[model samples]
Target: MARQLDEQIAGRFQVGQRLRVLDVGMGQGTQALRLARAGHTVTGVEQDTTMIAAARRDLAAEPEGIRDRVRIILSDGRDTGVHFLPGSFDVVLCHGVLMYVADPDPLLAGLARMLAPGGLLSLLVRNGDALAMRPGLSGDWAGALAAFDSNSYRNRLGLDARADRLDTLTATLAAIAAPLHAWYGVRVFTDLAPDGAEPPADLDALLAAEDRAGRTDPYRGVAALLHLCGVRD
Candidate 1:
């Protein structure tokens, strides 16, 4: 996801430009901190208190310059309008967040409004179209059969979550005037890997294969996660 975002940013923005970034549902601030270190001013909004504390601790460990570029905000992503003016950021990220939102349209619209013209809106969502893949591959016939009929499922964390189909999202983005720009599959082959599993000895090769499959279709369509970018025109 990070690699894909970086590539998109590099392609769209000029080098040395100090972009204003807003990371909604930033969790532990992994992407937020990485962008801050690269000289982008980043604001991370997280609703979880424990996550906020962890992110702050991580920020504090960074050098002064990097630390100064990051701000942590305690707020729900849906309230972004209350906290920030429209068109305030060059990049707005709402990764791994929409599934938890029962009604994601309003939140997605708010995120789109946060982007400046030509700004990027990056999203990482579970692939509803491929929801049956995991169960089918695991030989869970009943689960696979059920998955084909619904987008809601219990995630690894045992939380009830929803998934998004690419086609549906494309139409939504168009309606918000942030049309789909680019997209890639994520964790195409590694979705079934055990939680917290150590990287294989040939980690680099694994990533290489994943990257290739992510951009190559038929394969990409069945990936577990979809990394989508929209441009606010």
Candidate 2:
């Protein structure tokens, strides 16, 4: 998925350009810190106090220069408009948060408003279209059958959440003036890996294979997550 984001950035911006990035629901500030380290200004917005502390702790351990490039905000993803002006960011990321939103389109539109013209909006969402794949592959016939009729499910954390279908999101993005540019599936082969499972001996090979599967047809459609990139019109 990082490769997919890098590809979008490489294709859209000049080499070595410093971008203003907004990471909404940036749990633990992983991506925000990465952008800051690359010399971009990053604003991380997260509502969870525990997650805020973890992100700040991680930031505190970074070099002074990188730390200066990052700012952490205690806010919900739906509150971007209240905190930032329109066209304030070059890139906006909302990953893993949509599933928690009962109505994601409004929040998504607000995020789009924060982007500058031609700015990139990157989203990582649960794949609604493939919700049955997990249970079907796990040999849970009942669960798989139920999933085929609904887009909501109980996640690994035992929390109930909803997913977004590609077609639905594509139309929503268009309505917000950020049409879909490219998309790829995420966790195609590794979705069922037990949490905290040890890394495979050939980690690079495994990652490469997954990455390839993510960008390929048929396989990508059945992935556990979807990475979608849209550009502001």
Candidate 3:
């Protein structure tokens, strides 16, 4: 569910709020377009000019109905002065962007500063806790633990990714006094499955179950990575 994620985001919006939204490291304006389509003005900050060009071209090619809703600016997320102002946006998103940054702490601090009072910070990142799930499930607990401890999982970019857990993020957010809200496991079961593996009947059921589990108690502890939606207090 892409639609589920969209709905979850849209449900957070309120009409006539003149909401300003910033997408950190926005890629091709995926979430940006969705949020803009939902009537919230969106400004996307991207570091790559090529991506910005492509996003601009794509937006221009749209049916003129959704074309001008999103603004794409080329800038680094850590210091996106193009859109960064003290307490500017109502919602700030950092989806799938944290994995690329070598140091997330400074990026997080800047993001926290950009939030307006009661503004939502939505983060989507790879689940660090799932690093050993496949090995453990395959009856290789020792190997799993080793990889987990060493942080040797193959990231989506084909490089090593150090997964951050809920505890780590919670502690980080608490340091800023940001109030935490609901979190979810996105693509938890699908990501670990083999590429092109057709969803088996049982696996389909399992995926749906995991979606709920990833949002609930106990099971969420083992989720790939948790989505932390917090408000700046």
Candidate 4:
């Protein structure tokens, strides 16, 4: 996903351009710090105090140069309008957040508004259309059957969550004037991997295979997660 984002940034902007990045729900400030290291000015918005503490601890370890590139805000994604103006960012990231929101469309629209012309809006979401794939392959026929008609499910954390279909999201982005630029499947063949499990010795090869399938046809459609990027008009 990092490589994909860098590709978009490189293709959309000139060399060494310092970008203004807004990272919504930036857990532990991982992506925010990474972007700052890459020379972008990043502002991370997170509502969780624990997460903010963790991010701050991590930030404290970096040199002053890197620390100066980041700003941590104690607010959720919905507060963007109150914190910044329209077209305030060259990139807006909303990853692993839509599932938790009861009303995601308006939230998405707000995120799109923060992007400048031709700026990137990156989203990571559960694939609603492929919700049945996991249970089906696991031989849970009843669960699979139930999932076929529903876009809501309980995540591993035991929280009720919603998912978005690609078609629906595509139309929404179009209406928002930030049409889909490129999308890729994530966790296609790796969804079943156990949490905190060690990587296999063939980690690179496995990732290569996953990356190839993510960009290819049919296989990508059944992936567990979808990575969608939209460009502001």
Candidate 5:
């Protein structure tokens, strides 16, 4: 996911452009710190106190130069308006967050509002259209059947979450004046891999195959996650 986002950013902006970045639901500040290290000014907003503390700890460990580029805030993603002015950021990231939101439209609109014209909105979401693939591949007949009828499922963390269909999100983005620009499937072949599973001996080769499938046709359609990039108009 990080690699993909880096590619997108590189494609849209020049190196050392010093973009303003807002990472919503930035757990542990992984992406936030990475962008800051790359010369972007990043602000990480996280509601979880433990996650905020962990992110701060990680930030503190960085050299002063890198650490100075990042700021961590404690707030829900929906409250972006409270913390920032409209069009404050050049890049808005809401990765791995929408599934927990019961009503994602309002939150998405708020995020869009934070983007300057032509700013990028990067979203990582669970794929509703492919929800049945996991259960069916795992031999869970009942779960697979249930998935075919609904977008809600129990995630690996045992939390009830909802997935999003690409079409629905595309339309929503258009309505918000941030049309979808590009999208790629994530974890196309490794969605069923067991937790903590180590990479195979040919890790590079495996990743190459996964990367190809993520951008290909039928395979991408059934991927576990979707990485959607929208551009604010």
Candidate 6:
């Protein structure tokens, strides 16, 4: 996951270029800190005050030089005002956030609006289509079928939380005139492991194999989620 993140961030940056980066739903500012350290100016938009405070404290704890390159704003992405100009950023990152939203179209539109011409948008969405692939692959046919047919894997706030698929997300991006490049499966193997259970050597190899499988056709359909990137036209 970290390797994939580094690659995605690197795509939007050139060394020594004073670029602007926006990390919407910037939980803890992990990506923001990375871009800032690479010499890009970063603006993180997050609505949760507690999360904002923690991010602020984290920036304070960083070495003085890195902290100065980043700024955090307490605002939702949809409403960040003239504080940020359109076409101001080189990259816009939205990760693991669409899952909580009932309708992602608005957020998608908002990100598209913020993206500069030829600028990149990197998105990580929960792979709804893979919800049942694991249990099915693990030989639990009943549980697998249930997850496959259900709208949600688990109930949230007495409601179902729908998962997303690469096709649906790609369509959303296309609506914004942003075409996607090759996408890869993220967390394809590690997520299904028993928590805190270290894998044996053979199992490690198997996990790596599955990760590769999750990147290919047929197998990719069952991955935990997908990551995609491209630029607005």
lDDT of each: 0.96, 0.95, 0.73, 0.93, 0.94, 0.76
Task: List, in order, the clash count of every candidate structure.
Answer: 0, 0, 3, 0, 0, 0
For residue 136, give model 3's deviation from the true position in Å. 3.9
* Predicted structure 5, TM vs. truth: 0.97
Per-residue accuracy of model 3 over 116-179 as CA lDDT, tens digit each: 8877888887667676876687787886888677644666457765667777787887676566
Model 2 per-residue lDDT at 173: 96
By the lDDT metric, which is better: model 1 or model 6? 1
Q: List the residue pairs that clash in candidate 2.
A: none
Comparison by lDDT, 1 against 3, better one: 1
Off by over 4 Å in 2: none
The sequence of per-residue lDDT tens digits that candidate 4 reaches over residues 1-233 is 77667878898989999999999999899899999999999999999999999999999999999999999999878979999999999999998999999888898999999999999999999999999988888898998999999999888878999999999999999999899999999888999888899999999999898988988999999999999999999
All candidates: TM-score: 0.99, 0.99, 0.81, 0.97, 0.97, 0.81
Using lDDT as the yardstick, the better of models 4 and 5 is 5
Taking the tens digit of each residue's C-alpha lDDT, what string does model 5 give over 160-208?
Answer: 9999999999999999989999899999999988999988999989888
What ranges in model 4 sit over 4 Å off? Answer: none
> 187-217 in candidate 2: lDDT tens per residue?
9999999999999999999999999999999
Please report the TM-score between candidate 3 and the true structure. 0.81
The 10-residue segment of model 1 with minimum total lDDT is 71-80
* lDDT for each residue of candidate 1 in 55-89, tens digit (9 for 90 to 100): 99999999999999999999889999999999999
Q: After superposition, how far is residue 108 of candidate 4 from its true place, in Å?
A: 0.9
Give the better candidate number (3 or 6) by lDDT.
6
Off by over 4 Å in 1: none
Give the C-alpha lDDT of model 6.
0.76
